[model samples]
Target: MDMSIVLQAGVATGTALLFATLGELLAERSGIMNLGVEGMMLLGAMAAYWVSAHYGVPWMGVIIGMLAAGLISQIHAFITINLRADQVVSGLSLNFLAAGVSVVLGEGLNSIKGVAILPSFTIPLLSQIPWIGKIFFTNQGILVYIGYLVFPLVWYFINRTRQGLHLRAVGEFPAAADSLGINVYRMRYLYVFIGGLFAGLAGAAISLSISPGWFSEKTTSGEGWIAVGLVIFAQWNPIRAAFGAYIFGALRRLVLDIQGPMMILGLANPFYYNPYFGFFLQMLPYAFTIIVLVLGSREAIKKRIGTPAALGIPYIRGERGM
Candidate 1:
């Protein structure tokens, strides 16, 4: 396979992961762990595709899709934040709920044809900068470019601003933040909502930009889960998250491309002849995801690392300490 082609495709596919990872990262930063990212993505993809198919307006479809996912996220927020439910259980339940809703509502989406897709374009000066340009700046969807801007902006927002400091304070010490009158409950709800919006955007990116369709459960596949894993591997750092996302994206592209009937370096391609081997290859990314999630979870507990101290815990208004 052409390496540049693989990298180019990786960037495109990885954009969806970038969005999802950032969303989950933000929620986690605000002391909430949302495991319903996959469900939210699926719902967003279905809504975006369904809308675009009917109205011929991909942009509006994106808006409606994001809103749908964001609204559903409030369910998890209400249960975990308001009722003080187990965050993990609540998040997982939200996933099932959103997935069921998406499947039911998306019943006829895949059958629609001639839907309008989001636009793609090559940057003139930027697309000429050697390998980097070809992989990132050439004929990419508008959302891909947006991901590039969002990465640094999010990093800045998390680490370099007054609001970011408040976010960190609430996540690290909700009681302390509340003492300072920062409105801990309000902050968590807002970030969780923001997380859902990002997840929805990821879904819209897939149906309207990246893959350009609604494929039921297969639409998002398991990218949402992968994004969660990425956040763990990233240790709650946006820079690390972006790096991991792009690398995983490339690996995903490599898995599919290697199955083609072409020589590998100078030898024959085993996966080309033995198509069944593609299944194992396809599992590599997810296997890596599981490994990362398990190991990262252990490391976070042992080392504190970049983890928010209050993550996954419910905050009572008068509790003075964690």
Candidate 2:
């Protein structure tokens, strides 16, 4: 394969995963575990493809796609945050719901097997960079650019802003934040909603850029789950999450580019099957997450690199319990 193709594939994958990971990082930092990312992504992809196909304006499709995914994710957030439902269960149910809805809706709209393919765009100056420039900028859709642009903004929002500090407080100790007059529930809702928006955008990127208007039952595959794992691997940092996504993207491209008799040798084949290699590569991010969690749990790492104190715990205003 040409180096340009490899670079393009890696950049595409990284851009797609980056949006998902960044969204998940935001949600997780707010003390919410959203497993419905896959579902939301699929819905977003379908919506984007459908709108783009029907209207002839790809940007509209992108907007609709993000809104659709964000809306679905908001349902999960509403139930889990306001209703005090089990966050994991709510997230899982949302995932299943989104997947089912996407399939049914796709069939209804297309009366065909799957979704339509999307178009690509090429910016002039940005696309003309060296090898890396072409891969990252040229021959890609606007969504890819948006994905890269969102990173620094996300970082600034999460680490440097007062709202970000409040968000962290809500995630770490809602009760403490509440005592300080912070609206814990409101903060959670806001972050969760924004997270959904990013997730939607991520899904749209896959549909619009990577798949390029193609949709299938396995549209998103397990990329959403990989994003969840990425959040853990990144320790809830957007900058770190981007790098983690790139690493995974490179691994994914490697699986795609490798060929010939090298398959028989374990050196070339990371898993038994080629397609399944994506799954194994996906697992790598999560495996790394476990390793980090374990290491972070140790006294040495804990003192220096600790998890958000109240992650996954429910916060009742007047209640005192773990």
Candidate 3:
């Protein structure tokens, strides 16, 4: 029960959630509900592995991975935003599409094995601090620290910038925003693309950073869904989402890392020692996701601060009524 190990592992896990959550947050803020995040992440993961294996540069894989996922997400954008298809169905379809395509591409790419992991860089001077250094700096990747920067910048963009104000206005009231000379459709497309970029990056973070290898296996393990839930749980706040990611990250890590150690020492909980508990343990993160979502719903309603008013409703532009 070393706290530092938990902190380090938890933050590593949180980094993935943070990226996916922020991506979804951007899309939702602009009135688009992109459920294809899981698909996008998977595609990115596969692509990251292939490119990293071929080119021998994790950074190139990251760039290509984002492009691949972002491109896939744009199809959802076109279907939902342009053709006005049902957003949910389109996103779900995108997920299946990615799964199928990944299976196909993965067949050939699976031969390219054991890609190198992105290097982890420890910050100088800061790494010398006793507890803070170990928990925050030691063995942490650059992307984890990048999440710290992204959180505040996103907070400012969403809450303080004029364009973000317009984006919010578009999500909450497209008709009014249209009346005020804002292009509703454009805003939705913009945010959706931004969301896709982050989702792709999330997937790349998985293959390139965490596990450091490629497999046809479902690498994300329903993280995209948890990310979706996290948006609701955090009431769409980047800062809050960041906090929730780490806490839940710790919970998932506890399930994976602690169970075997505890059982070997005969100090395990009954639940942990159960023969059938392995699958259930995997559900810990999602279960906590559901709980947080339910808990947040009350606060969201109480403060009148949850959800955009016009989210998921496509704007027909100059048509009467919603």
Candidate 4:
């Protein structure tokens, strides 16, 4: 298998993961831990596919998908922010709710065919470069290029800007921020909504660009969970998150590709000969995700580093309980 093809596909796949991970990172930075990413993603995918199939407009699908996911995300925000419910429980419940809704609503979508899909194009001068061009610029989805710009912009926003500082301050010291006139509840709600928007966009990327159809819950196939794990792996840094997303994407593609081809290092490909072996190969990505999650969990607990201090804690005005 050509490694360039693997990487190019990885970049496209990774763009979806990048959006989801960035969304989660932003919410967590504001002291809101949302575990409903999976549900939001599934709903986004279903909504995007449904609109595209019906309207024959991919962009319209993208918009509706995002708005639908963003709207649903408010449920979690209200529960955690207003009712002071457990973030983990609220997120998990939201996940199940969104998944069931998508499956029910997306019932007949699988039979739909020839729906317009998001376009893919190659860059002019940049596509002529050597290895980098092949992996990033040539014949890639427009969203992939957008991913390139978004990571740096997000990094700057989080680390260098005043608003970014306020976000971090709210996460680290909500009471302090409240004393300084920053509306703690407002900021939390806003970022949680933004996170939902990003998650919705991630779902759109998959249905409209990467995979190009709705497969119900299988449309996301647990990529939302993987994105959550990636937040910990990225250490709450956008640049690191982008890198990890692409690497995981590449690994996922590689696992599938390795199952094909006639030879591996001049030897017969066992996976090709025994197709059932592909199941084990397919499991590699999720297995790696689990390993990364475990390692990241240890690091966060051992050092208490990079984790927002007030995360998963509700902030009541005029109190320092969190």
Q: Is candidate 1 or candidate 2 better by lDDT?
A: 1
lDDT of 2 by residue, 7-106 (tens): 6777777788899888888888888888888888888888887787677666788789888888788887788777878888999999999889988877
Point out the higher-scoring one by lDDT: 1 or 4: 1
Global CA lDDT of candidate 1, please?
0.93
Q: Pick the candidate with the highest lDDT.
A: 1
Residue runs of model 2 more than 4 Å from their true location after superposition: 108-129, 260-306
- Candidate 2 CA-lDDT value: 0.76
Which sections of candidate 1 miss by over 4 Å?
A: 294-303
> 1-322 in candidate 4: lDDT tens per residue?
8989999999999999999999999999999999999999999999999999999999999889888888888999999999999999999999999889999999999899899999899999998899999999999998889999999999999999999999999999999999899999999998999899899999999999998888887889999999999998988989989999999999888988888798989999999899999999889889999898889778878877888989999999877465
> Worst lDDT window (10 residues) for model 4?
313-322
Work out the TM-score per prediction: 0.97, 0.83, 0.93, 0.97
lDDT of 1 by residue, 219-286 (tens): 99999999998998999999889998888888899999988756898998999989999999999999
**Better TM-score candidate (1, 3):** 1
**Model 2 lDDT, residue 106, Cα:** 72
Q: What are the runs in model 3 whose C-alpha is more than 4 Å off?
A: 108-111, 263-276
Q: Could you give the C-alpha RMSD of every candidate to the true structure, in order shown?
A: 1.3, 4.1, 2.1, 1.2
lDDT-based ranking, best first? 1, 4, 3, 2
Global lDDT of each model? 0.93, 0.76, 0.84, 0.92
Pairs of colliding residues, candidate 2? 116-213, 117-213, 117-214, 118-212, 118-213
Which structure is stronger by lDDT: 1 or 3? 1
Q: Judging by TM-score, tell me the better candidate of 3 and 4.
A: 4
